[model samples]
Target: MGHDEPPQHQVVANDLRRRITNGEWEVGAKLPSRARLATEYRVGANVLQKAQERLIIEGLLEGRAGSGTYVAAPRERRRMVRARHREQRGGSPFRGDMAEIGRSGTWEAHSEARTPAPDGIALRLGIDTGELCVRTEYEFLADNQPAQLSVSWEPMSITGETPIVLPEMGPLAGLGVVERMRSIGMEVTTCVEVPRPSRASQAQANLLGIGLGDPVLVIERTYYTGEGRAVETADITVPDARWEVAYEFGIDA
Candidate 1:
């Protein structure tokens, strides 16, 4: 066959896809390998490989590493179950600037800022009370509303040598104080998270656009070096009605 000719792999993939959709092969059923399909369809290995990839993308097949390709499980079709579905939400919800924050379906990256740490915050960065520290503040938003305010601190003595502390460093420069420190030779091996529910203070209430008596969510995180040295600490606040917290765990065997 000519190089310009329509490859036989595509033909085989289309046929298999049609059969699966037509209920000939149910979910979890195994499919033939590139070599076997090549023989059956009188096509080259390259063509068979191409066809398999197309089926995988179309959600008609699944490929597990070291395992052979198989018919894909039918996905649970979800409809507009609610008017305020996750996808309908906008930009970073935490900040008024971003319509939604966090991931559209799950989490989103809200507002992020890098500034000099204050005296009290310096202690959290493992620096002297008066030492220089970079403070990166993030407000996680959900569906374009404030979910949480996360403030991270890092000693300028550690990251000062890098441009990550610069004013116009741009977003995503130093995602979190821990990651930024790691980029400059400091490895954070431990993290401590503290969660609490309380009322938003006057300043916090202003930032969050909530009343003083309103219930709020607060989270504090501290990142530490390998030797139990605390490298950074964060204080976050979130309004209760605007944010939802989700956590999942998987144990390694």
Candidate 2:
């Protein structure tokens, strides 16, 4: 192969991508069968399969398990903004986040007994490995459609025996992290966020309705107390096919 030449699969994917983007194939329209497409492109079925897989990862195509491949509908790109000042006002971040994206949101959260923190989670929350911590899993929905998923951890050393320990089983139930910590006299003052793009894990893909290996945005966030102690940390997942994560600040009053 010439150094300047692109891979055959990539070349096929580009041609298909162009057709989809150009509206040659309207959204939700089925593409030619693999055998037919391979013959049309003068490539083997294996090569064409690889090409369609690229489009699938790019959100330009979707393959239904038994229904063959089709052009994907244009997804609504919901903006996910992280403006510190807005959150300082104190409320459910999930609710506000969805509203900003022009959708009504609800979530189902399940909290579990305090358990030994995993090494990665402990490091993020600034706790020792095997230390007791409260874990909560959340599935956030916009208009009843799954939009995001998260898993959060808070060290039991800080919340143990407190009314806020369960996170969703007290007077402070459903309150945001900053507010919940405040109710227990821990003043949460700063939050740090690190964002990265990664292939969707099977669990995430199942919940978000995207194929495995599709792009998704993962946010690792930690809230700190006034004394710089990490109070809580969470891994937030949003399917990139359906949301556009953005950082907003400096709003004029």
> Where does candidate 1 stray beyond 4 Å?
1-120, 166-174
Report the lDDT tens digits of candidate 1 across residue range 1-253: 7888766766787788888889887899888777998888887888888788777755678788989999988643222111122212332222222223223322333333345566767655656665666655565544543445666666666556676553225443524444455666778777666678888787766556555567876767677889888866878775765554543344669
- Which 10 consecutive residues of model 2 have the lowest summed lDDT? 82-91
TM-score for all models, in order of appearance: 0.49, 0.72
Q: Model 2: how far is 27 from its true place, Å? A: 6.9
Could you give me the TM-score of model 1 versus the true structure? Answer: 0.49
Instruction: Name the Cα RMSD for model 2.
Output: 5.2
Query: Over 4 Å off in model 2, which ranges?
Result: 1-73, 251-253
The TM-score leader among the candidates is 2
**True-structure RMSD, every candidate:** 18.6, 5.2
